[model samples]
Target: MKEKFALGTALLVASTVPVFGQQYRAGSSDTMDQNNQQDTQRGSCCTSCCDECCPPKDPCAKCAQLWPSCGPDWIITPGAGPCTADGCDFFVTAEFLYWAVRQDHLGFAVTLPEPETTSVGEISHPDWRMELGFKVGIGWLTCIDGWDLYLNYTWLRPRTKNETASSKEGFFLQDYFLFGFFGPPGDFTLDNETAKWKLDFNVLDLEWGRNFYISKCLHLRPHFGLKGTWQEQKYDITANATQPRGSTQFFDTITGSADLKNDYWGIGPRAGLDTAWHFSRCFSVVGEFAITALWGRFDSRAKATQTLFDGSVTPAEETTTTIGTGSFKTEFHSVKPVMEFFLGFRWEDWWCCDEYYTGFDIGWEVQWWGGQNQFAFLPTETRWGDLGFHGLTVRARFQF
Candidate 1:
């Protein structure tokens, strides 16, 4: 009985030792797993904080490295980009404009169909007025450092009208008059007469130039160009007569019409300087001044006609008659000078894109030319005149 009891106790002790050993091994594994999880969480938090606080180096530095000549103090240039080998350095500009033309003198004629005519008397300079005009221009640029080639063209047309009232007693003939049936010069007079005048003026210009940048904010351009100007002047005078006058008998009234025309073409060289003051990255004030020297051709002509009215008939019977018609043409050379100035605001990188720009400008311009000849009624007598124009200009431009 004692041997069986001792064997049973040894078997129980052995079983209990194995169970305790298994619990110790399991606890060691769980502690090791917890330490690893804590370490992983700490590492993740440190990485995120560093990323948020730190900034990377500039990417432009890499560009500088590739192009060492750009230097350390490099700034991105406006208006044009750096030169590249693939030919991306061309640009174009288009503009629409309105100009308010000031009154100008083209030419004046004293008489129509020279040599003194019985149908018409002496005339003086007619009053001229100008209306609003429109213009369009296009420009192209080919860039190479500070040097570039440029071309531009502009056109404008303005309307004018005038009227004058004079009594037949106030009418006079020119001193050089030769042939007239109304006795002597200044002796002929029409009764109750009025005169009307109309004029049209047009101008066109085309130029090509090379640009030289004096600085980042200034430039000088020298150009050679062509200009064309055309003008037409018309006059009409009407008179009421109750009786006959000097060999010619008019039953009722008479109307006289006169037309004068001129054309001028010029070729010349011009030079200008342009400057800008920038108040912001996208806004600027600009000013420009230019002078030109031109060799020009001027052409002039004149014509006249008359119509008789008979109030004795119903609806006032009318008889059309060309009392006298004559044309005089001459070619002469002259010089013209021009000046212009402007101030405006500009918006760059239009539509949030770097390739486009738009701007507005208000300015003034003046142009003058000499050696214009005016045709008179007497072919022997011609008057020399000068041309001048001064005006305010407003323009909107777009560039790409």
Candidate 2:
């Protein structure tokens, strides 16, 4: 009887052990599914983009900010004065410009005839002084699929004055040399020369663009626009010759004056890219590049006059195929290409319930206008020289 009882108890215990093990395993599976569901819910909370940006292996706590497309940087937004996070509607910008002009063709005087000295044949370049200018702009952050509109005006008027004295045996550079040929000066030896150059720059730009993120830390703004420009340049020089290279006799004084002007008005298409890499919530490094193709009219004229001590005058003026093909003066209708570049660092922030915005930045900018230096057309064959400007720009912006 005892042996039968022991066998029955062992069978019952074995059956109960297997049943308990099945139940525990089923509970463990259900618990694991619940935990997985919770983790998935937590990780899917990031709303910055459409695709699932969170990694499966990462902790749920970091899922919100660990977007795969974005690095540790924030997107730069161009919203109004107080509202920028979601989308901006309007903003205004103003910039202070301290710039200098670089023109390649304005050579007024040359020193003595030494092959070793750098100044022997080199044309004297005037001091490129920095002048103040201003730019004002208004933009609309449409928030319509992140599109924006901008209109702005820029103005600058800068001038440079220079004076040069030549050695007793050196002649002043003939005011305007002929294309492919630099001929002799009117006088044998030049004593002194004075020159003044002035420029008037006016521009209006209208752009349509959209800003978006390419990566977590980088953003790009691609833009297309119309650029209109009306600019004028004037260069005038006066030279005096008082000595002869051969004879020591008191030479008859010869004076020369040249008036040169180049003016243009054009309207064209402009395209550009603006980029920013944000390292912090409110600070970024930025760059911009642009190109313009202009279809417009250019008017260039130069007149040279020589006065002798004997009350005689000699005047120099001529027409070229490029200048007077269809017109009465030295003017033409053509296309000009211009390029611009900028790089800088900026700080921007928003407060007051994300309803206002303010920003500040400083940058270096350059603009190249191909074949824009038309100051010498007549008295010399139609030759072209490139013109450019480079300098510092400080900008302040606000949104409302």
Candidate 3:
């Protein structure tokens, strides 16, 4: 009780005391640096903690408190970083994400051209969007050459939706593995079509980095990390066809459905650079670029079913045009590379006499996975598709 009383007394006096010629940060009003000159012998490891509570370089440390987690001696080795006699050894962060994926592979068919129409094979595309997800992380400051270690996880499951398109004549499916399993090229047609898509994305990252100044106005953090991803994609399409057979005076009615799923997980080394151009203590512009080479396995499946309900207009004569049901599953291991980029603006500040830290960042991020859309229907047939993501990200961080 007595110690608390004295500590409160010291703080009240310290805040009001006027100290002259305080050294300012070289570039900005705030550099996350303590209010003192850096030690001459830089990067020297602190062998002990202060017993007397004298500040690392201030008279404030003199009104010291008992160190709960400190070394045998009182003196701490000096460095300019987050971890100071006052505070800043570790941090926690959270982020808000609103993102969407590209719709390249979502389209399955093209509108067939009729006798007098300019329909040059219009592609059917589905719109996919995401509402919200979360990214959370923790970090530890080693205070060794300003190095830090951190880990984070992200999870997002996009909403599923169906998009439909129709034609009076018919729709044509691409001959490649997209629909090659059921019919011959350019012969199969549909009266109406609908497409649906769903995706589950998971990512984990562990990194080691150090933030330091490259120039008066520029700061950078270069990090090397391992990233792991477990991603799954499901796509479905259904089509119906009703055409009159002039040769037989009957109607050829066909209905079919196709489903494809690509599930994979990979882990590999990732490296990146985080750059910050500080316009002032409270605001900065930031950008990042990272690449990872992932070694992973892909378990893919493709199945299709088609049925014929052929009948005459008069119901006097009838013939059924039936199509078969086919399915195939395969799993393989391969290596692929992913590249991601981001740019944003940041606002940060400290309160409570700089004992704690808080920051906010808003930005845009993009990611591309090479050959992520691996779809196959037969042992010999394979289709490679690239997956990409673009989104808005907002981050909030607190440190002590």
Candidate 4:
């Protein structure tokens, strides 16, 4: 009987061994209870050993996590402000865009190439120009709930095409020297040619955007808004051969300085959408495509000229120089389309408190814009050359 009782007790102890080894069941509640009990016992029995034995872990770290600002080594509010798990309430950013641009003049129609000829005049003269440019901008941001809105102002300028000057004789002189038919500047005359002009513009825009978080460290930014853009273009058209003899629209008739300008302004509205992908807490990549439609005018005005000369009486028969101005109300419109890919790094810290935040972004961009100009023959002949422009831009932002 004693042996049989000892055997039964051993069997009961053996059964309880499995339960002790498991520590918890297969359910989440059981697991949580077990973890809590272990944590408590470890804290009570081995305070120093507990920290060394179990390291801290982020319970929620995954792609598409909600609350992107909750990550390791991230500073929420560095300055004097109320601390929050999210981020600073106010922020600013400074960004710059640097790009390599390939562009040309939107000139008149090109006559098909005549059979190969030796004369520069017989060879077609199409205005095909090339240049490079860059732009800079500053912006501010306001966040409410889970949505973020942005307002930015950008200043862009073409570094290469600040100004351009070309005369028919200049080309002739070049050809003559290359072909070994060297001659003086006035010895040759050119006709029906347009002067090289400086083509550039500046843009100001206000946009509202919204971002949604998918994960603790990752989010998606999809936004659409209206942007206001402006432009300024100044160029010259010459009527004289070597100097300003007939008009002063291209150069000074007396000093031989060919510095004439015709200026115009363009204003319009642009509407489009962009998407951004955030990786980690302070790094992101964005892809944007937008269509811009603009309206403005172009007028014909230029510098004054000197009086004409009587060629019949004097040996140097300088004709009386009279200047005439023509004003044409031009409406310029285009489906200005742009594509840009950018990788940005962000520093999310408000300097003086949760009052504001600041950051900087830069990247590459390509643009293709074409529309109708007042120079068109008809009011509706909205066919301008398929012109292309490319460059880079940098910008800064302050968020509130």
lDDT of 4 by residue, 1-400 (tens): 9999999999999999888767645466787787667545432211221122223334332211222433222432211111222444444444454444333433321222234244434332234444434343333223343344455555545433322223333343122110111122343333233344454555555555545444333445555555555554443333222344354343322211122332344455555555445453334465566665545444433332222222333446546554332222343333444333444444333333223344455555666645322232222332233334554545555554
Residue 280 shift from truth in candidate 3, angstroms: 1.4
Please list the C-alpha lDDT of all candidates, in the order they appear: 0.46, 0.68, 0.69, 0.40
Clashes of each: 6, 11, 9, 43
Candidate 4 has its poorest 10 consecutive residues by lDDT at 173-182
lDDT of 1 by residue, 345-396 (tens): 4433232222344556566655555544343434555555555555666666
The best candidate by lDDT is 3
Candidate 2 Cα outliers beyond 4 Å, as residue runs: 1-88, 114-120, 168-188, 243-251, 310-329, 377-380
Best-to-worst ranking by TM-score: 3, 2, 1, 4
Task: List model 3 lDDT by residue over 218-309, tens digit each.
Answer: 56778999999998988887777666677676667777778888899999999999887766545679899999999999999988887777
Choose 3 or 4, whichever is better by lDDT.
3
Worst 10 residues of 1 by lDDT: 62-71
Rank candidates by lDDT, best first. 3, 2, 1, 4
Q: In model 4, what is the error at residue 193, expressed in angstroms?
A: 6.1
What TM-score, over all chains together, does every model reach? Answer: 0.57, 0.70, 0.72, 0.51
- Evaluated against the true structure, the overall lDDT of model 1 is 0.46
**Highest TM-score: which candidate?**
3
* Candidate 1 positional error at 140, Å: 3.4
By TM-score, the better pick of 1 and 2 is: 2
